[model samples]
Target: MTIRSRLLLTAAIGMAQPALAEVTLTRGSSPVPDGEALSTGDLTVQNEHLAFTIAVDSQAPWGVPRGAIVDLAPVTDGEIALDRIAFADFIPNNWSAWPNTGREVEIVTETPEKVVIRITRDFGEADIATTYTLEEGSDRIHLVTEMTNRGDVPLVDQMSGFTLWPDSGYILPVPGLAGVDSGSAEDALSDRVVAYDEDWFIALHAPYFDRVEYASKDLYATHTLAPGETRSFEGWLQVGPSGDLAPVVAAEIARGDIAAGSLAGQIASTSGPVEDSVLVVEKEGVPYIWTLTPDGSYEIDLPAGDYSVYATAAGYSDSAPQQVTVAADGSETLGFEDLKAPGLLDFAVTDSAGEPLDARITITEGQAPLVEFLGRQTFFTELDQVGGVQASIAPGDYVFTVGHGTGFLTEGEEVSVSVASDETQEVDVALELIARPYENDWYASDMHHHADQLEGTTPPEYVARSELAAGLDVIFLSDHDSTANHGALAEIAEMRGVPFIPSAEFSPSWGHFNAYPLSLGEPLEIDTSTATAAEVMAEARRLGADAIQVNHPFIPYGYLASLEAGTVPGGFAPDFDLLEMNGPDDDDAVFARAAQFWTQGQRIFLSAGSDAHDVWNDNTGSARAYVHVPGGVSADGFVANLKAGRAYVTRGPLIEPEIMFGTELRIAPDEERSLSFDLTAVNGLATASLIGPDGEISSQSFDKAPSTATAEFSITATPRTEGEDWVALRVEDTAGKTAYSDPIWINPLGEPDVLSQD
Candidate 1:
């Protein structure tokens, strides 16, 4: 049957009465093979409306070892729509049985009408068996997990369930919430959670689950299990087309049999029937959300209980709660009175050039009538529309702050305004650019940034928006082990007139490396499963990477850590192009290590990045690389300059030395040269030091000097006893932010250096 027809049939089944359909289960190789990633004992299950593949043995990167739903798509499309869905860790016990564990799969039941496949894993003291079942005529896959304690100690406060990865740009629907992004719905209202994108949706109906938490790419639920006894938790997975979720909801309602009563209500405001409003019904402190029809009328099935009902809309006040009691199989009708009209706040933000500037807007005093989710407190201008935007907010006195990211001077840009009901207020904000590194042919880029990879909470569009707002000249996308957001970021970069570099953080068991300027449409060729650091770098180079970066080299899982301990597999390969100064905390350590390499006659340059994942909560470009792209900021130009070591790493301060770092100067012994430094900091400069292999050569204290400062130093070229001598600048601001410049190679003539040794 065609996928279109199957969708139609699924919709019919959802709307009509429940009927039985045949289900088939097959065990063998994966129907959709991903190389040699899956075990030979994979399972494929399908009904009239749904289909899925369970990886009995997963060997792919980041794959769950066994019993993970690796591939899920509509029976019609047959395309992979999900990454994977696997069991999460058991709480309190703090144990996860999947991913690097042994498991046994058994066919517990085989019948034409019903089929059940159970996967069992033993965790020494506890045994868990997760079963997948599909019955005739059912459009959902039912999953039940039973955990039993086998050891002498009793397991207490145990909770375990599955985690779902729906990729990026999926909306999550729960009781009391609609149109919430999957990452923003950390806490939902009901047991049924539906994540839908423009094409398809996957729903988790867990009537017995106690709570669920959502990250950017995945979400997991937990159910209470008792100790010393066997406990089973049940859930249903449903998939369908996007638009309507009726089919899944209907199946859940019918299976659970909890819809014993009905509540009908009408929501009306002073302006008449409220449109685009939400009806919230709370029973026993649990809130259920219902999307109202265009006429502001809603009818919902409920269990016998007393509920507090209210209504809320974007541009209106929430209706007063009305309490009503419902009997078994009974019906009740309730009406809501007036909902206050919202006031409008229109803002116009401009840059120093008097052009419309895309800025970040925040409400300091009063709250906006909009729903508050993760990172929703701040709004960006020109996100959906060009120029200024208007917001509907509650009528009150408010302090609205408008500004760009750190590079702009918006210190006193807060405006106070009183909003009246049904009134419009206008506010204007003008911001001045403070740090102008671009004018000096320097372009700033955050080397390590993520969007919707693993636990990342920011989407691609927001990633672009946030970085642009942070005044970054070049945008880089380096999601861990995935280039899924590369194309999207590239397109957005084109539209925003910014240079973009496509990169991915090759996450291996050993460490993580970022390979940049990767070609689009090319599959990631590097596999770190058993490859050494040197092999990974070779593969990255073979895959057409212009530069390979060692990320957070001094951290626990960093490559430098293993190299330092003399435990790096295949020993240390100094073939990497760049080494990261890594955010704020690792600057000193990384700098010290880089100095050692410099004194060893290695030319590995320095790079800085915030390693920002949740851009909404954290700032991107907090630590950035300033590269000298004198020609222009293009992907090729940036990479070329970075390869030549024409760059510096900074957290906030900007340093420009007269004799630019990365310049090779061949001088006679005892030749004197004068060097001048131009430094700028948003939060006043503290000190500037000229550093060499032996330590500080000369230093100047700024005493928290304002915005900009300068210093000059005269030094003589000294004979190198061993490796070539090099000098660099290190500056610290009063805010404790630091910047490190690439070394200025002081190659004294007739000295035994890297060249002579070679």
Candidate 2:
């Protein structure tokens, strides 16, 4: 007999009952209480090795119990672990939103071998029924779910699965899975299953690692259910201690019988033919990988079963999955072709002088964005293993929008292109580089960024290349709490002729700060490194940071904000030189908080960064600081200029405001100043304000239309009562983009210049 059959017979003989055991189901308070969330139901199930409480609770979404606290622990001689595993009734795609746990939970059957519990939740147009069977002898649970669509419309691409969190341990991917990290909290996506091990191992028979919640990993499957039809699927979870996974994996391999079958497909591409493309074949929810032929055709040998097949490539829109079924044992052929293809978008960017210019491109159809490449300065015209600006786009009518940064300005062009099947269209974009007041001396920099940190493995060379592509004059390699790749990236930066700033992100629970001129030999730990923010800031200063900038001060755990709430140990703020006022997107709250601190007499310089991780998905220098490095651009020189407060941070809009007096930009008390402003933007300016210690002293509205891309302003102003009253220029474009200049301080009427100026 098979091992499973033999074990079943033994278990039946030892534990069989004369009749079904009486199961008394009841609703009670939460078994594992954490907060003020309302409880739905509590269930207790015990076996020789495990005792778990399935507590249902309502949190986040209203009127629904979405959280399933699987308070599970190992039981030894009736004793259980203090820590328990808690999870929720989470669907992989619904990790962000809480999924509804049915209005009622009931125990339908109870026996020595199994306990079957049924849960039903009513949707507005449909309802879902999930039955969980907790079996004896093993910690594995069988989940059989059925969803009936009662509405007229058929539901498509529905993802449903459990979100589980084990108390401890990381998830190991399945063998031979061809996928990368999903870039969420989840560590990875596997082809067949994911295993979690702490003191014991729990294997989930699901294909995708959806996300991570605290210490737990979410595993799920995707399906489509037609209206008035019932769709059903089975999921399994097996558990054991240490060396017990061999049999489990062996059993699963046996269950998935190897069948002889062949798959054929062709990729439709307008750019001659698709090469180096991939065809993903998911069999019974497990993804199997295969490479496509050079002419966009593919053939695969797969096990006999049902499969969902799709095609994918870089810069191409993903194709819809085609369902196919194969016969077991016999040679069968399945065809998945005649699908719509993606077109090729080959474009180049340059300045009016025929020199490459860093720019951002957006391809959109009506209101839907197709492909977007932000902060792209250099274009690679050659084709090789690694890709360039060339994109394989979906066939459609798209509007191409392009904009430049810093020394370059373009009203932002919009060209309409109709992409047809199997065609390569080449387009050229030329942006005009305007010579501002300090044109030859200014250098743009993004001080905060990350790569290959937990989520991705973006290499050091790619990092340097991304910086050049974004047209950044300088980039600081500040991976979170680690400077592992600083030296390697610095070498690449040197090769690319860009200044590299060696830095580390002291990302602590209380706050995050960047330390420059990083010493790699020094020890740094995420936990137990520094107890308080004060000590961490002190450590950064000791590490030779010319000036420490508070990162994202308005976000959660942001230093200045956390300090205000007294969350950090120290009551007083740290002695930092700069404040990050900009990131990928504009946050008015961050700018307001920084301005409040400065207006309250704090000496702070403003800075900006893209905070980009994956350059393919993000824009480098979407927001950047332009430092006036008149002494020539060097890492030390740039840091010195930042410390001297001779810089302005901008997003899209370009503004050059100057107070023509001394090179130091200083004036005596009540001194008259002749100010000149040269501003140009893809979106014209709305208003320009001159802010002082007591708030706005004067403001001017540009007379040009909101769409006007360029303008200049020159006006004179005088300091009223100069006791540390600093004057700064702030401008806003019609599109709500902003730029901020460093403040020029007016010395007190009788006081002498205070500290040594940069």
Candidate 3:
């Protein structure tokens, strides 16, 4: 069936019940006969005769291609195995849609978030699949597949599956998944199996996670499907021998994220009113025309033969799929089944000027059943050029609203429409001025990054330039005990018009929390070879800087130091800002611990940063801080916000918080008060709440569901009456984004002894 029918089915079923669509595929049936399929095919070593590669054998019936499982180049005396070939009795399903020739599995059953393919296996069919390996010659890369026929009569099974080896580097073409690669020398934690591109670069993302074990040198990653099932996928994977897959790949292949592939060979067609080239046809989906006021047609290609077509658009009733016959190399004329353009809902959004507002515009459906359309990308629709944009929607009535700044929309503006499929619905939009969404919102930031001074950029430049371009509101010039870029960036930020925080990544020769922000030239004065974290943080605070956090508290290197040890540190530098949440540096356990730290109130803020730096921008700026300044676009405002603790950091999401006792400035922690503020979001949905000064204190959750929401959170904080009063909120989104509000300055009912001042 075509994707049009599937989307329609989802929409209809969605209105009645909550459900998510899943894809399935049948057992492998041999399509092409296996030839000399050498048990030991080809083998070679490259990369200055360091890495190794060999043709994999077809053994277990799990789905993965027959190629060099390991580059074998990065390691000395590395080995490759060509184990058994056949069907994986263990796979037990048709997760491998095409059973034999080396298929690519972009989304697998393990991590069900992406476009997934699962196999509900039925043992009764004589289904077949294949699995292979080239591990340290371990059995993990081997395949054992078989076909069974249980019947009174003879049953012939023809199974087919494809396996394309991992490439050096690849550009994933999925809607949201981008540049990705795995397998590299820098993979210290060993969380990956089939590394995508090259090697030899220190790249890490989402580090603080659950598990940090080196994915066994002999790792198993495959996908399979069962009988009478179907699977679908888009994009491609580039398999090669030499490239960096060290730290970041746009998308994680995940535990079961088998592989990435191309949509190049899929069958599809496009049609609408007016043969306007403005709308270039993309991919294998049908376009259902609701109102074709002026019908137009386009061309499509199908492997020389009989074909079927389904057309659709929003708000229009789905039409019955049509079957058309075509001759080879032929062009056919197809028009909008119902020729008419949906009434145009066009608008010229502009700044205060009667002139058009030149901000990005997005039209999301506000009439219930909302879906996500934005992530990583800055605009709702592809920004083709400067000023103008046009979009096509189903003629059904819609409440269209547009947003430009990082704030809320001007309430959903309902627009009714009635136009022929061939007609254009023109409702020119005029965006008005509104408050900046992140204004006054607590923004979080991390002051470290390393852009090796080699690849046309340095660590400080990574902290300064690429980060700002990718929307990181704050960054510190923290290099590996190197002050080279801090001074350089301070001047460059001034010349290039960007913000730069002076800092340094001080390491004691031993690998530990190496990042600590400092004044531009601080690194030059410190003897990092002998300094302790306490001494570093002490100097940071002594420099009149605002805050300092213990970076990647869980990463183990020399001394086997843990976050717990760093926290007590002879009580030196005890009072501080945070313990790096280090989302990008975490393994599974690290991520869980980060969450636990927030819930338990570790006495320090939870922060995340991207420890990214590679020849390529792998997960570059994947994790960053979002400091909520006054949205006026000034350095002073940003600095004040940083000192105030109004910030959040993440690979995605935005937030804002405010606290008050009615109108009085005295919203003492000892007294309760009414609190309110706006929460603006993009890229991800999140949960937020108010927390007392104590980290372990129970807080309130957002309470309301936000769909482009401008919500009010009112909670009372009966703060400690004895101590200097302070109340704040902590938030984390479903996507792992974390933020901390700067403690609202509350008048302490009494003063506690500070040992020195008291």
Best by lDDT: 1
How would the candidate models be sorted by TM-score, starting from the highest? Answer: 1, 2, 3
lDDT of 2 by residue, 23-83 (tens): 2233554333232223554665556555445545433211123324345454445444432
Worst 10 residues of 2 by lDDT: 369-378
Candidate 1, overall lDDT? Answer: 0.68
| Model 1 Cα lDDT, one tens digit per residue, 1-758 | 42234445866876585544456777676554232225567777766656677766553343233555656554433343443232222221222212123678888888867788888876446777888887766657888877887677765544455555544334354664443333234355556765554345677776655444443222333433445778776777877743234455455556756545667778888878886565766755554434344568877666567878777766566777889897666778888866777888788887778777666677777744323321144666655553377877766677877766564233426878887889988878778767677788988888998887654558889888777767778889887667778888888888877889988887664467888888763566654544667887887777679899999887655787757655455777767888897746678888898898899988888988888876655677878899988767898899878867888988878887777677776666887777788888877888889999999999989864778888787777888788879999999888788899999888777443223211
Please provide TM-scores, in order, for all candidate models, with all chains considered together.
0.68, 0.56, 0.40
The sequence of per-residue lDDT tens digits that candidate 3 reaches over residues 1-758 is 33234334755775676323211112232111221123443333222112223333322211222332222223223221221112111222212221222323221422211122222222233333322222221111222333333334433222222222221222222211112232222423222223322221111122111222222112222223344443222111122222322112312322223232211111122333332211112122321111111123333322233444443333232234455554433444443354223333344444344544334333344222111110111123222222344554444444554433322222223334443444565555545443334344433343446654211123444344344433344555555445556677677667655566665554442223433435556544444333454775555666545655556655542212323334222233454554454544453334344344433434344455565543133333455555655454345555444433445454444445444211113433444445554554443346656544344344434444343344344434354434443445555545455544434444433332111110
Off by over 4 Å in 3: 1-446, 453-465, 474-476, 509-530, 538-546, 555-576, 584-607, 614-641, 644-653, 660-672, 683-687, 693-704, 707-725, 732-738, 745-758
Q: How close is candidate 2 to the true structure, as a TM-score?
A: 0.56
- Candidate 2 displacement at residue 428 in angstroms: 3.9
Model 1, position 382, has a per-residue lDDT of 58
